[model samples]
Target chain A: MLTTIVILLYICVVLFDFLPSKETRSTKERVIYCILLTVSFCVLILYSLDIKVPGPTEPIRNVIETLFKPSK
Target chain B: MQKEMISARQMFCIIIMFIFGSSVIMGVSSGAAQDSWMSLLLAAVFTVPMLLIYARIIKLFPEKNLFEIIEMLFGKIAGNIIIILMVWYSLHLCALVLRNFSEYIQIVSMPETPQLPIMIAMILVVVYMAKSGIETMGKWSIAMLSAVFLVVIITILFSLNKMDFTNILPFMENDFKSIAAGAFRLYAFPFAETVLFLCLADAMKKKDSPRKLYLYALLFSTVVLLLVILRNLFMMGPGMVGASYFASYVAVKLIDVADFFARIEGFISMNFILAGIIKITVCLMAAAKGTARLFGINNYRKLLLPVSLLAVALSAIVYKNVMEMIDFLRFYTYYAVPFQVIIPLTVWIAAEIRMHKRKLA
Candidate 1:
């Protein structure tokens, strides 16, 4: 859902926004970090989209659902 | 120089409104129905004496916290036990509140994101707010108080067309027990929970706070709460109101302007942003303060993250879904009474008795 994607992206923005200044990191290191962050964000997005998240997603969902469900 | 950084009036207003703000807006109507507002009025009458008692205790201690007062009265070991129990209650309180807010979001958005992350995110925010100290929190509450009132007015005015007095009819049809049960929860929430505000009273700008200010805040916040419940009842009716979880959201959804732009429930979401944050922050601050006192730590804020992470973890484990949480609330009302009312009253009485003996000597 678009709502889920927006929220995830917002979290990414908030998290990355906390990163120290670009001048502190080497260009190659920053690029590597960016790639990793982007991959993780995409993976979370795909999972939130319910598109069959690839990497051990079921366990995480179950753990999460168990904790926060309103239907308790 | 400001002896206390805020006034008791501001503190009282903030406490009264934010103590149970999210609960009233989101949950109270679901269980109490048409009489929900009446229950709150009953709560006010029941709680003022309790508040007065707490005020007296604060008067005696000057700047000491509840934990310190316990230690002073009971000695270190016995005092530590009381403080530990208080800490346990505080941690549980935080988890329960976090669950409530996460439930709110899950009902509205983020259906698949899981409750843990949402809850943890909120805990993080509250921790940051707590680190900022009471003044920042007080200022935020002032802003949110305005937002709560403004949204309240909007809901009442916008829903005027759908108002029905019949929804509130047949008041107190049940026997004394049911009414008392409802009234007790009414007091337990938003009212009795004002005990948490004492943590910030020493930070109040004025040392001497008049009872009138307390009355004003109580009346103002109560009116808003009442109006919100009344609106929910009128819009959703009693059965539906009591049956559903987010009655106010449903009430707002009933509003439609000019055939287009239906479902005004977004207002409830906006309301949550303010009310939800305040709820978590207040609980976190109380818990952190309690922990700091128990451990003899000079700074309570330092413990915020540990307490917050623990709360998030507890919230994650506390319930399987929403129903269990509601069930907890159902029976938890009885359990909450002692903590919310009895303990504080006992302290107040004990302090008074000690004072009386000292005077005689």
Candidate 2:
């Protein structure tokens, strides 16, 4: 599937971009960078697999609608 | 930490483009229908004080962006918390804009193409721009503003034939309360969204005054937006304008000058893309910079790709359909107040106090 290929391409690009610069950065920097990278990859992979992730907008929407509803 | 600085003129262009990001295409403050122009004008006038507040905050610490200012004022932990919140806000805004762009493109140009590829391609450009640094984004804004303005002017001229000045006749039809609410909605959106610019203030040259930059940009954008709204009002009237998702694009679709000069809405789409990119790029850059500061990293570019990818995914999942997106926007005026106004006002007051203390010392 095209989704699998796009996910693979993304992983390859992230590795190619970040791995070579690993030695130049501090451990803290590398950890944060990897954490961010891993998070992005996980989200994209989940999306490619057609797995739904709950978003934060829904709760905000609920609260707004409740608070601003027209009163009869 | 960006070494290259942009002149005030470049800042002006970026601000104008940023405000016009998705508003011009989607129709800002359309709650007032035919009177949306009045809403936008009132919003612009009301924004002058808020603009001064932002300018004064930056002037208080000429060398610092909003992130550094927060860190300095609030100390490390509290400051990082605020920065994280801001980063979240910026990413959320970027996602919303990306979704808007993809939806517009899908509806107008490519009906069959899946949104994933379009969104991926757009995020790629945004990541590259964010990685290239703030000065490059500023320079691009300068070059693109001329073309954007040219498209606006031409669209206005060509669409003049379809415009009916009488369509806007029965103004104030919504009563004073609704119009004021509409003005407040407009204020919360495009006008007040300039708070994000505080993140890029340090990128402006030392000689460039933030007040002038904000004022000039606000005034110019208001004029162009008024013209765009009038075109939509006169061409589509209040009825169809409110019914359509992208009112300006629909209005331009009615332009048929001598039957040879039709389908010129593509230029408006071009304007949309240019402004959208600048807006998203700035948001991504701000989020990345905030992340870098939070993690004590030297370069923000390291996080640009990941953050932008996150934004792309968020855009995909934000709303189920365009109608949902519009519905959220209708409430966005209220939801955005905390980030857009309250937080910035807090920072401005803190900055003023700090400045007074320094003067006394």
For each candidate, the alpha-carbon lDDT, in order, equals 0.67, 0.85
Supply the TM-score for candidate 2: 0.96
Model 2 over residues A1-31: C-alpha lDDT tens digits? 6477567757766678777877877899878
Residue B26 shift from truth in candidate 2, angstroms: 0.8
lDDT by residue for model 2 (B1-361), tens: 4465777887898899999999989877448887888888889998999999999888888867899999999899989888998888898999999999999999999998877788888988888887777778888999999898888789889988888999998978878767777788889888998999888777877677899889999999999999988888888899988889999899888889998989988888999999999999988888888888888886778778778877887887888888888878767877888888888898998888888899999
DockQ for each of the predicted structures, in order?
A: 0.04, 0.47
Task: Let me know the DockQ for model 2.
Answer: 0.47
Docking class of 2: acceptable
Give candidate 2 regions above 4 Å deviation.
A67-72
* Steric collisions counted per model: 12, 0
Candidate 1 global lDDT: 0.67
In terms of lDDT, the poorest run of 10 residues in model 1 chain A is A52-61
lDDT of 1 by residue, B71-121 (tens): 778788977887777777777777777888888889778887776578757
Candidate 1: C-alpha RMSD to true structure equals: 8.6
Which residue pairs of candidate 2 clash? none
